[model samples]
Target: MRRRTLHLAAVAAAALLLAGCGTQRDGTASPAPPPSPRGCPAEVRLTAADDGRALCLTTGGRLRLTLHGSEDRPWTPVTATGGALRPVNAGVAVRKGDAVAAFEAVAPGTARLTSTRPLCARRPGQNSCPGVQRWTVTVRVTAR
Candidate 1:
């Protein structure tokens, strides 16, 4: 009887250990989800510059722009309005070769950046050109 009781106690302990392993130290079942990306918004805000040359934004801020294209249709930068805002290193390609470019506010002023490339639709054996696709984003940087 004592042996049986000891065996039962060991099994109970093992079961409790397994149950606790799934829980956090604070007793929550799992960790919270990570916060959304910084400097990215669901909708782009269009603000005009005082000089009518660029859009307005805050210094030290960033703007995230995403451009979609086929695997063979990559985007290239056409123009950057001012020196206040500059593109970050290199653009990143996501699903199906879609590209994402990030621009950082470097100073307190106005700026704009334009990117262009031929838009194409790729089929199994051929590609169709719709025309040149141009994208422009302007910013007026203010002191942080």
Candidate 2:
């Protein structure tokens, strides 16, 4: 009886161990390549208005940004948006050398531009009062 109980317990423990065991994965899989930094080569530089705000636009090297306002007025919200940007001039493809950098004050009320990742946002205040945004840009290069 003692030997049988010991044998059953051993079997149960072995079964539990085997159930918990998993195939040992080998080494590591290399990390996936980074996304293209050449995403935008186009650039736009704009002058701010007396109210201290403006919007800019560019399609691959060609830049177009507009400005408006009183810099010291109560803060207003703003947003920037784009669709399939077609050139005012023809046969211009929005490619690497072609840039897309434009921001227009959609409205005059409490609106501002927020510079997030790949795109910028233009809209009125957030869930509260006025909002100000700051953006930093960096360019990088890597082997294909």
Candidate 3:
């Protein structure tokens, strides 16, 4: 009788563990997908122009991104995912103006571009820069 009780308890514990494995903290079965960009289609496709707006891209296409900011609040591209995109040129400025940062879509895959800028005052010789603002955009590349 003791052995039977122990075996039943072990089976119950295993069942409970398996049931909890696929649940999220909110008790949902699966995580939600990322939100689609506003005014964009639900399906992935290239936009008509590369006007720095977030949109999907066709494989082997080109995208032109322009980052603008003042000298004290300069923005810069931090990273890009996948090998489908390559930067053409990038720059920094002290005054508000357009800085062309172009990229090319090399292959069919999803990619992300991230840029950031300082939003708070910085002291001399300080290692850490606080109040950093980040901008991230997702791009889907589809084969033609």
Structural similarity to truth (TM-score) of each candidate: 0.48, 0.18, 0.51
Worst 10 residues of 1 by lDDT: 45-54
Report how far residue 112 has shifted in candidate 3, in Å: 0.5
Model 3, C-alpha of 111: deviation from truth (Å): 0.8
Q: Indicate the TM-score of model 1.
A: 0.48
Model 3 TM-score? 0.51
Among all candidates shown, the one with the greatest TM-score: 3
List RMSD in Å for every model shown. 16.3, 20.2, 13.3
Local accuracy of candidate 3 as per-residue lDDT tens digits, 1-144: 999999999999999986545334663333223334542232332221322334566666666555665566667644688886766554433244223456667776777766777875444676656787655556766565
What lDDT does the true structure give each of the candidates?
A: 0.56, 0.33, 0.56
Which regions of candidate 1 fall more than 4 Å away from where they truly are? 1-54, 77-79, 89-97, 122-130
Worst lDDT 10-window in candidate 3: 42-51
Query: Residue 100 in model 3: shift from native, Å?
Result: 3.4
Off by over 4 Å in 3: 1-54, 89-99, 121-129
lDDT of 1 by residue, 53-109 (tens): 223556767776665555666666335677887777545546554556667777876
